[model samples]
Target: MLEQYVRKILTARVYDVAEETPLQSAYQLSQRLGNSILLKREDLQPVFSFKIRGAYNKIAQLSEAEKARGVVTASAGNHAQGVALAAKHLGIKATIVMPKTTPEIKVKAVRARGARVVLHGDAFPESLAHSLRLVEEKGFVYIHPYDDPDVIAGQGTVAMEILRQHQGALHAVFVPCGGGGLIAGVAAYIKYVRPEIKVIGVEPEDSNCLQAAMAAGERVSLPQVGLFADGVAVSQIGEHTFAVCRDYVDEVITVSSDEICAAMKDIYDDTRSITEPSGALAVAGIKKYVARSAIKDQNLVAIDSGANVNFDRLRHVAERAELGEQREAIIAVTIPENPGSFKRFCEAIGKRQITEFNYRFHSKEQAHIFVGVQTHPELDPRSELLKQLDEAGFPVIDLTENELAKLHIRHMVGGHNDAVINERLYRFEFPERPGALFNFLNKLGGHWNISMFHYRNHGAAEGRVLAALQVPDDEMHLVPEAFNSIGYPYWDETDNPAYKLFLAQ
Candidate 1:
């Protein structure tokens, strides 16, 4: 079976569209980590992703009749672009079913490649179901994003290039795992050719399909997947890929969304390339691995798989990168209402730069403040800083590791209304522009009184708003109307666990 796959990978005709991207050295990252770090620059491919290799290989292997009949596939974004570009090159009509929740930039990219675009459900699973129907009804050949043997074989070409480019004493290659296509293919090739070189798989903790499959000893469906790394937000690993991973892959490692953001910054510092969240997964894994293990002064390789990132999303990434790298520490502090309390807090902080500060006067007795302080990235300063604050008699709560504190509560601090009846809190995302906040309030504020509101501009294209509205249970119908009329995306936080624990009355 492995020999057959080797044949398929060797014969894959991907160069008609895909490029043999370079394996570039990340000098800055290497220096910082105290290890030689090489980045497999798959992000430089024609579609800004290695997906074109698999997509083009699958399409090229098709019979002339099959090509004429056309192909259909469901994708979140990167694979759609790949299939679209491959179809365009082959002069084959392609129908791409993509999630409605896919970024507008990615959707437009697929359409620009001259494919027939169909916006289906909100995620890959639903889009897959819709595409399968098209395959059955329209007589279109289905080019699955990652499952098929041909696609996996095509993806192996990346490992082939990696070996040829770097002939040094290679320690390990970290491949970002999604549905397991890339890692499976790379592992198969590397393990066959160079058995000593470890093939590690990296995945986002929330969407670790490959890791979960390996643990189960078979392919298993995830109940849900996080959309932060939308490119690799697969619910399950493909059967073929899972088999390959089970046999050839050494181990799988998971990293968080914040770590991925920091990896993006690291890649940018070295390669000047802004990678998508999933694209930076391997880099994040490398950082985590270095910190966890004694491996040092050794050669490490990470597959920087794609760069099809939404420009607006970078704002959020930039905001979280510092925290992920441990360069910033967030803490909740309580100070007296007296005039010299803030001065005393500043003196305690010493010379460390404050990244952010949020405070509201809740009572005459005390005031709570959300503070972000810069610190050494490699070392955690939370404990020492908290100790200092404790010794100084200032109360402190470490909000750095708190998810709810970082995402929602930091913005929603104070202004809790016990007087307002039937108050429903909502978290909303609106297109960021001049007067976006005013427009949101004006459009949604019909007779429902806005009892509480909290918003802070992170300079992203979307503005997140936490709002509490006063409306009676009998007038619940007005809530939907307000949302529909506002035309901004909103999620009810009235019963949100975080809201209940932190902000709700």
Candidate 2:
């Protein structure tokens, strides 16, 4: 049935789109899983996604009278670009309705494709309703992004290419699920050709409409959708696509946002390609299922569905990648307030490298310190570190699991000091080479006490250092010259905007 529909659409459309994408083998993933792993590179398509195939096919199949009436669509990101580009290629006027909060980059890309972009509502459903209203009022053809027969048929071309490229060696195929168009098409074709090959559907655990619908044995709407994987953040699967998925897909898996970030990094490290969180879903699901089922020495294929990620989000992905692997720990340790107590606490930590340290001398009797430590994989080093501190007669609290400690305490340390003393904060920029920070610490005059300091080597040529010092009120003016003479650029907190903001809070 799907093949017949695909043939009909191919015959109706004058444009050719079959020769663009490639099916590439993933060497790193295959070795890691002990299986022959292949990647269907729909990400390499002209629009950087498989959505174009379906969008173009659907629009091409319209009757001549319908084509003259123009087109309208509602999409969050990738699909919007697909529709806009397809309309431009076919010489059809298209109006795309997108959420107001859609990324600026996506909105610009849609406009660049010669489509009139309308920012409406706060979510896809609301924008979709608005688009439908425009279709009715202007007599425009509403091009359903995923629910039509032509769209599903066009998407099935991915499966056809996969079969030709891999030659039936696949034991399982993983596809990310949003509104289920891509998965529905792929599963229908793969099941028809290779009934033994398992068809797995993947979804973000936070917005898992397909998984929930399959469990209930019927379509169900999600109460809320997660925007982290914005490309696949669908609240409900389409009726036509869900019908194909219900009959063809063998299993469905849900992956967390952290897991998706890890997968995105993995793909970048292996293939040097940046994939959006949605594109990484298939790879994440395959890795998760292989570990869960202990499947070894089998063939696997993961469809890299799209690569339309915003570059600004990469920083957040990099920050959370290590935590996903359990290779780092953030904790708070309290030590004695006496002289040499800090040295003893450092000694107790032994061989662990301190990634971050923030502290304040609270009272004459106690000091609070927040520290982040690098730990061996597969072990909670916090318990052992705490035990050693306790044995050394220091009161230690494990703030490893404290959300507040992880988010805020590390950055705001010096505010807890006594008001009797005068403290000055300075921002210092210095070279990032080894021991540069230590050298700055060593140059501090003995009379001036170090109150608080925070520095991180961000893999840049230069490093930023924020330090607070407690000194006699008369010595405050001399501190800037002290840093300047040492060839370090420094800014006093009195005139720093960040300090004013923090003080205001």
Candidate 3:
């Protein structure tokens, strides 16, 4: 089985459209991990993903009659781009059926390559079904994204390049897994050539089709997959790909969404390049493996699979990266409502940089504060911080691992307080800088009671804040004048429907 794949991979005609992307050294990651870390830069391919290698290889090998009939496939994004570009190169009319939920940028990318784009149902399964129907109706060949033997052989070229590029000591190669195509191809080639070097597959925990299959000893479909790592959000492993992976692959590692984000940041820090969440899976797995096995001084390679992530998604990635790395701790601490109590709590926290702070005056006796503090996994761990706060007589609830607290509670800490009467909500945008919030608050003059406040720093040029001030109906006209004096751009959100539903009285 492996011999056949090895032969096909050796003669795979992927270079026609895909580049032999460099296996670049991850210098920073190497130093930190105490191992020589190499990144297989598949993100540098023509389609910005390794999917092109298989897509082009399969399409190019078709008979003249099949080429004339054209080809069709379904993809959420990355594979669609690869098929579109490969067909255009061969002068074949290609039709790509993509989920309606696919990003417009990807839809445009496919169309840009002169492929007809059919925006179908809400997800890949739906679109895939539609593409198969097109295959039967139009007599066009359907290019399977991962299941085909030729496609698997095409992806095997990645492992071929890795072995040739670094003919030195290599402990393992981490491949990101979706439908098992890349891992299947990579594992087959590596085991046949360098059996000593481990072939490990990395997957998102919530979307781990390959890992699930390995456990089941057969292909198994997940009820649903998380869309965070959308590129690898496959529900089932490909049948052909799984057959190779089940035997050839040594191990499969799963990483969480937060870990994936941290790996993305780590890759960016080393290479100054951004990769999609799925692209960073191998690195995340490497981190988990190293931490678990306590391995050191070995050569490990991680496949930086693709860079098709949307720019807007970076904000969420940035926010979660710290928490994923165990570098940030979120806690809800109860402090006395006395004037100097907040100051005393700050003194207790001591020297640590506060990433965020949210407080509300729920009662006259005590206040619940949601705070984010910088922590290190080794030096100043969350346990130590909790100990210190406890020693200082501050009752704290560690919300670091609380999903509800991190996702929604942090933002909705002080919402719709009946006691916060005569409240007028205003959203403010100020230049982000040290003491900017302090200055803004100082300018407010402390005339009216600040009933509610919400602020989160997103590492942006501008700092946005949502705050409500208690102002009588008669004094409402003076609110805009006071904001004008503050000189920050402000919006009246008191009447905003979202505010009314969630935060307003």
Indicate the worst ten consecutive residues by lDDT in candidate 1.
Answer: 496-505
Full ranking by TM-score: 1, 3, 2
User: TM-score for model 1?
Assistant: 0.87
Clashing pairs in 2: none
TM-score per prediction, in order, is 0.87, 0.75, 0.83
Screening candidate 1 with a backbone cut-off below 3 angstroms (N, C-alpha, C), the clashing residue pairs are: none
Q: Which of candidates 2 and 3 is the stronger one according to TM-score?
A: 3
Which predicted model would earn the best lDDT?
A: 3
Per-residue lDDT tens digits for candidate 2, residues 220-329, read 99866666787778888989988888878999999877778878877887789999889999999998898799888888889998999877678767865655454566
Ranking by lDDT: 3, 1, 2
**Which lDDT value does model 1 have at 81?**
93
Per-model tally of clashing residue pairs = 0, 0, 0
Worst 10 residues of 2 by lDDT: 496-505
Per residue, candidate 3 scores C-alpha lDDT tens digits across 1-505 of: 9999999999999998899999999999899888889999999988899999999999999999999999999996688999999999999999999877566788899999999999887556789999999998999999998999999999999999999999999999999999988999999999999999999999998888888988989889997676678888889999899889999899999999889999999999999999999999999999999999989999999999999888877987998999999999988888888889988999999999999998766568876788999999998999999999999999888888765456545688663567668888777777555677898887864668887777776443346777878899998888877888887777777774434434566
Candidate 1 structure quality by residue, lDDT tens digits, 1-505? 7788878888989998899898899999998888999999999999999999999999998999999999999886789999999999999999999866566777889999999999887446788999999988999999988888889989999999999999889999999999888988898888888989999999999899888988989889997677678788888899889888998999999999899999999999998889988999999999999988968899999999999887878888998999889888988787898999999999999888898888777569887777899988546476788888889999887878766567778666663456767888887877555666887888777668887777876543356788888889999987787687776667776875445534666
RMSD of each: 4.6, 12.5, 10.8
Model 3: which ten-residue window has the lowest total lDDT? 496-505
